[model samples]
Target chain A: MKLKRTIRQVFAIAKTDFLGIVRNKTAIFFTLLFPLFFLIIIGFTFGTQGTGETSRIQVGTVNLDGNMIDVNGTVSQNSTIGDVFVQVLKDANFTVYEYDVYGDKDTNGTAAYDISRGEIKIAVVLPANFTETLSYQYTDSLGIPIPTRAHLDLYTDPSDPTGSIIGQQSLLGFISGFIKYYQEIAINQLPENLQDYAEVLADPITVSTSEADVSGRQLRWIDYMVPGTLGLVLLWSGLNHASVAIATERTKGTFQRMVIAPVSSITVLAGKFISSLAIVYISAVIMLASGLLLFQVNLYWNVPAIILAIFLGALSAIGIGLIISSIAKNEEAANSIAVLISVPLQFFIGAFFPLDIMPEPAQIFGEALPFTKLVYAMQDIMTKNLPFEAVMPEIIYLTISGLILFVVGIIAYRLSLKRL
Target chain B: MNLNDIEIDAVTKRFEDTVAVDNVSMKVAKGELFGLLGPNGAGKSTLTKMLCGMVNPTSGTIKVGGYNIRDNAMKVKELLGVVPQDIVLYDYMNARENLAFFGKLYGLSGGKLRDRIEELLKFTQLDEKAVKRHISTYSGGMKRRVNIAAALLHEPQVMLLDEPNAGLDPGNRLALWEIIQTLHKEGKTIVLTTHMMDEAEELSDQVAIMDKGKIIALGSPRQLIKKVKMENTITVVPNKITPKLMEAVKKISGVKRSYRAYDEEEKIETIKIITERAEDILPEVVSGISSVGSKILSVQLSRGTLEDVFILLTGRSLREEEQL
Candidate 1:
């Protein structure tokens, strides 16, 4: 009978409390709306990567068999007789595009290569007399160096500002690189092959990546925002609710009436703590429901473990709020103290930035704050598909922190009431 | 001391270095409407709090219905219904819910809690507005009523009030007095502290006049008046009596306690005389005064009031004690 009555009274208080908060439209908006505003702000600030226009280039080339120069050093794949000299564009990745050379009659009438936008920015034009040019490789022609050659022309955009800068800088890189191998023929640093290669290599470089943790598909903006938004509920719940409940009661003379009752200080505190827990959990469920309905974030109804973690996280938050409320004598002081402490803690915990981007010391500090661990635990459940045991480290520590704080708050409340 | 009565014994409360209540002792019978009359800092509220076991006495004991407050604080709270002066109540809750919550705190639950709340609402005359609005929307008088209702939820035997009528309008004050009278007749001991002397005069069966952390006088209003010489008498006020005439008036034997009633507005002084044998002393006082300004302004005094009794004992009016 006593248990039944206690439950009934608890819910009775809970219902009135819930109604009070819901009826306060300003309170509702500050808790729910301000978090959404932060979610959007922080989400967009860090979410943009490889989203804007591509500036530099990624260029590759392959060299096929080379032919030696004939005895007069003028032997090569010389221009063929009476053949068309048509130029065409082709994909460049390690194999250069070839433009077969007919006898060079006014070949300069065609365009000079553009070295800004295309994959290779240039192509090689093959001489048709190349059948006889290979016969010179059998002999080393005196002291006059034997030449192996492929004449290439670079085509580029010339308009993109970023492309223009790299289009010029690569000339220096190619000269340094080519000097290691092509120096047998040309002793000077500015080799013709290096200059031509620089003009064609417009796309600079790239090394793309994929996360080993997130599988199947990349998370959308809303997916990332969901975890952060949920964390914010805990954060705000911890920072605001208890102070409002207790302080308003004090102002209305309700606390004095309550203190005069047959109820112990512990019972009053438990009532408030449980009420806060219920409210924060309801808010979490609402946010999750909205996520599944409006944002289509991942939801696994069978995952009791995830639900349990969420409940614990919210309870820890409420415990923190109760500690704050216990110290605050009035609504204004409670609000001032809560805001003063929570904002900086949230930032230090990396609710605004990923831990990967922080330095090692900062990462260590972030791990110490409860929200960072909570956020990690949530990310694991939602994104990593990890089980509850995977987040036990965080769960155990946060629960301990919450317990210590709760006990301390109760003791402090008793002391404060004693002084009163 | 009556074990059946409420008693606060040797109760001294020290706040840091300042002693607010010092070795105060009081006792009243069951069903008594007792007035704890004091100035603002006479420690009356603290004494009441001790009776309800809200605060622990530094070096004393309090007993409610024979239960010591130290050993049985909860039992004391269970028996005492405190209507605090500040009108403390859950404003977020409606009148009915506030009553229900307080009722449940003492183990009244389920249908009983609801029924008690309903009955209290009717008793406090708040039933009509019970469901219509929250307590915050109520007027000051209505809030005070709800506060009283919350206190009466558990049906305590003693109703302790700390100036329940301090800030009410005359109509509300009258209505509140009627409620206190009804409670007292129902065999509940009602102890209230107030600075309003006339309230103590009208409603109190016994008045405890406290000043400077002690009760200077305690008795029924009539008994206290009879303690002075004006049990069935009148006072004489004659303007402009000479020194020799004042000596002659004091020597009339039946006349008691001659003093000047200085009128600041008229800038004139009057000699007042209180006597049970005012008719016998009137002719003697009349023949002794011979100046034009010494004419008797009013000579017919019938009954003595609490104010006259307080003046006779404390050498000042009740209003004068208030300035302390």
Candidate 2:
């Protein structure tokens, strides 16, 4: 009879608190509205990676080389190494703006002006010795002197770091392609006897690469960010709402009345936890539905595991909120403290960036936080489609931390009642 | 054996360095309306909190309905309804919803819970407006009534109200007193704390006056008055001050204390005489002033009130302790 009464009282309090929160229109609106903003903002910003106008990069080039004289002693327009270099960059889909070798000052000045004005990202300058060095690679047979290496100067705007990086990559690709073309042509111009040595120099080390996905379908950035935004919605909605609700009750003396009532302390805490858990689930559903309809994010993978992850995540978040409520003196302090804990973890926990790419100590700190594991567990369930056994470590750790915080929170709540 | 009697033994509660309740001991009988009278910081609320098991005494024990508040706190809570000094009801919930929520906590449910909520709404006279309005929209008197109904939902034998009438106007105080009287007639033990002296005199079968965390005086109102040798005073404002009139008024029967003072601010000369019965002695006081060829401008007679008893015991009025 006693146990049955406790359950009834717990549910009674839970029902009242749940109705209080859901009926609060401001709470209902912000819970869905704020995360939808994250979905549209973070999703579209990082989501569309290789589509439309965003993927194009502009490059500028200036060749000072006059012309190339073939071993037949003819000026071959196609045989000039500078001409082959520009053709290779053009083949890779770079819009190359070519400048004259010995023209008036206006020719090279305009290219430099475009680079500085951020009109172009990369500037390639080939000197007069561009083909003269290549013509000497065939001269060892004649005992004539040959230049050892050719220098290709690359320039980019110092202030435009992102453009500078892309332009530098295009310049490097052009250099790599010109080396192969010069080697093949030089060996072909030589007799058949030295061609094997030229082939060995041109293709010194053979490297191969391969990439495959587990589902055979490429996951978009929206797939990864949706789960993170869901975790974020859970953290903010559960922690802030629960802490403020408990603190408001304390200030209003309603919490004292409940503490002094015939119900047990666990009943009061359980009621708060259950209500926050329901609100979190509602918040998660809204975020997920918005992802599906608005961004075409997939939700067909591991539905049960997603639900479980959300439940455990809400459990841990609300447990922390209970601790905040127990220690805080008022609603404002509780809100400030909850936000202080949740905002920093959002960045460090691989929600916005990968944790492995960060420094080692920062990675360790991110791993130590319970939110990091929750985000990982969410990714495993929602994005990776991992099974229960695969994600058990995170679930177990979250459950243990949640239980500890919940036990401590109940004790603290009871102690606060005595003071009140 | 009175089932609803509450026994508190040597209870002391300390919050860090400050002692809130200091070794207080009291026993209230069953079916008695006991009033705890004290100034604001006199430990009355803390002592009642200990009895309700909301606060733990630093030293000593309390028992209600034959159950120890320390070990059987839940059982004790089941036997008492507590109306805290603060309005502890949920303002976001309507009167009916608030009462229903608290009622379910005490193990009432289904049709029984619904019926009890309706009965309490009507009993507290809140049925008419509670249907569509939240408690936040209710007036102070209406909220107090609902607060009482929420406590009485379980119908415990003992009801503890910590100054239920503290903030109410005169009409609301009278209306709430009528409810207390109705509950007392139903044989429920009721204990309340208040600074209002007349409330103790009008509503209490027994009263305990507390000061500085200790009970300075405890007894029925009449018994306390008789023990303190209570006196009433009669004051007369004469046109001029004279020694003969002061000497004559001091000789009145049962006149114990007298003094004469000239007010410079009001430019009035006044004579006051304290006696056992001011009603009997007032005629002589006025006649004595008239015989001196001094016309009495105004004459006033005051009875022995609880404030008089408090001043005689503590040497301070209730207002002084509250200010301190």
Candidate 3:
């Protein structure tokens, strides 16, 4: 009979409490929507960076192509095809800027010629000796020239010149490649009777590779965030439900009524604790399944074990919630305290960033928190391909934290009962 | 005192710096509907809370059905059903649901829980609306009834009710009387405290009128009423032969206390006398009226009542205390 009464009381309290939770839309939002919001923010922004894939960098490219000029009725036999330069500038992270260069036309209706101004570096100039220099096999600035050579003038700019080093290096590299290839074409074209001062050796073995270009399949940001997002959902639901149980019921006087009932103080606290756990896990699972379906979160290597970790993580989360509920006198205080606890912990625990890049102390501080261990366990399970044995410490910590919180919550609730 | 009776032995409750229930004691019989009547701040709730084991008495022993409270806390809780003075209940659940929930808490289940809920609902007249409606929709009186129904779920051997009639209408108050009477008939020990004199007079087989945390008068309703000196009451009409007439009425024997009319009418007055009988008192009063050359306006003898008894004991009516 006593057991029957207890069961009936539990059900009675559970039903009313469940209905109360459903009626409160704000709780549902905190439990369900808030984590998704954070996930969207974290996955696209920090998640990509934390998991070793850098976000795309925007590089501005300025490709200057030169045109030929006629000087004193003699026209230069060099002109640059601008379309080819544009094509070269349009590679990854490249925003192309095309400009006209005028340097070797100082005598052709040009008042002044100054390539010293840093408007464009590494400009292509079609010099009057361009074709002649290429045919005679002369090298300019450590290069062998071919016929109809594209005269590339390399300039190093000082002001507004952050990328000057890379710009000059790439420009010189391209010139070297062009010059080397032109030597192959120009030198062979030269008569065999005429011997060149520079002897060309073409027996260099070309080592080719198509083996490890694994760059095309970039890392998806969703992998790291999916676990953190799930942890957040559990955190919010657990904390909100635990804190709201007392305040909302007290506001309605239902708590007062229950206290007057035959139910013990511990029973009331346990009932609330159980309800908080239920909300946390349910919110977690829903968020998990939806996170997987919506964001395609990685679930590899004993998915059941990952699920168990999340459940246990949720237990600790609810324990934290109990601690919050025990300390806070009302809903507003509880909410503020929960946010203060949960938000900063997310940063420390690798929810917003990975623990590795941070200093060793920060990582230690993070790993000490249950969430750090949980995220590590979750990420390792989902992304790192770690087996369950590696994650036992996290499981143990979460279990210990949960038990401590349960005991503390009971003690605090009983103390409050005494005061009442 | 019967060992099986509920005995409150010199209980005093101290809260922080204040003493709430100061050295108070009373004994209730096995089947008596005992009432503790006092104004607000009279430590009625404190006493009852101590009895129900919600709050511990600072210095006292409470024994119910031969079970000492300090030694047998759980046993006392199991045997006692308390209807708190405040309306305490889960507002989301319906009447029947609330009753069944509390009934189950007391160890009733299966058909027994359902039966008790149904019985309480029908008796409380909440059966007609038991289906699917939430308790928050109920009126104050209905909610009070549900609060009561929750208490009776365990069918306690001893029942304690505090201010159970506060929100009920007169009709419902009378109905509450019937319920208490029936409970008394079943010989369930009851300790109820209220400021409602009429309720105290109507239902209780014995009454304890408390003041400042102490019981000043304790007796049956008739016995308390009989303690007053007057049997026949006299009323003097307020008239213009006034000062002389007031003096003349004072000169007349048997007149004890005089006052303006109970209702503040200009021409009517009231006086009470402690006469051995109205038969002998009426003749002298009628003759005094004729002899004084002022015509006998009105003279009648009225019976003493518990309200007067309260007045005799406390020098104020129950409602007067409420007004204060």
Which candidate comes out best when scored by DockQ?
A: 2
- Pairs with backbone N, CA or C atoms under 3 Å apart (clashes), candidate 3: A5-B104, A134-A146
Question: List-wise, what DockQ does each model earn?
Answer: 0.29, 0.54, 0.25
Interface RMSDs of the predictions, in order, are 2.4, 1.3, 2.6
Among all candidates shown, the one with the greatest lDDT: 2
Worst 10 residues of 1 chain A by lDDT: A81-90
Clashes of 2: 0
lDDT per residue for candidate 3 within B1-324, as digits (tens), equals: 464568889999899888888888888888789988888877887788788777888998999778888888767778888887777776666777677767756667788788888788876776575545777787777777778778888888899988988877778777777777888899888888898777788888899887767777788877776766655555554333455655666566766543333423343545444454667656776666566677755566667655566666666655556667
Report how far off residue A290 is in candidate 1 (Å): 3.9
| Interface quality of candidate 3 as DockQ | 0.25
Best prediction by TM-score: 2
lDDT of 2 by residue, A271-353 (tens): 88888887788888888888888788763467777787777777767877888888999978987898798777677777767
Q: Quality of candidate 1's docking, in CAPRI categories? A: acceptable
> Stretches of candidate 2 above 4 Å error?
A29-36, A50-53, A56-207, B127-130, B233-299
What DockQ would candidate 2 receive versus the native complex?
Answer: 0.54
Error of 3 at B166 (Å): 3.2
The order of the candidates by TM-score, greatest first, is: 2, 1, 3
Alpha-carbon RMSD, each predicted model: 12.4, 6.9, 10.5
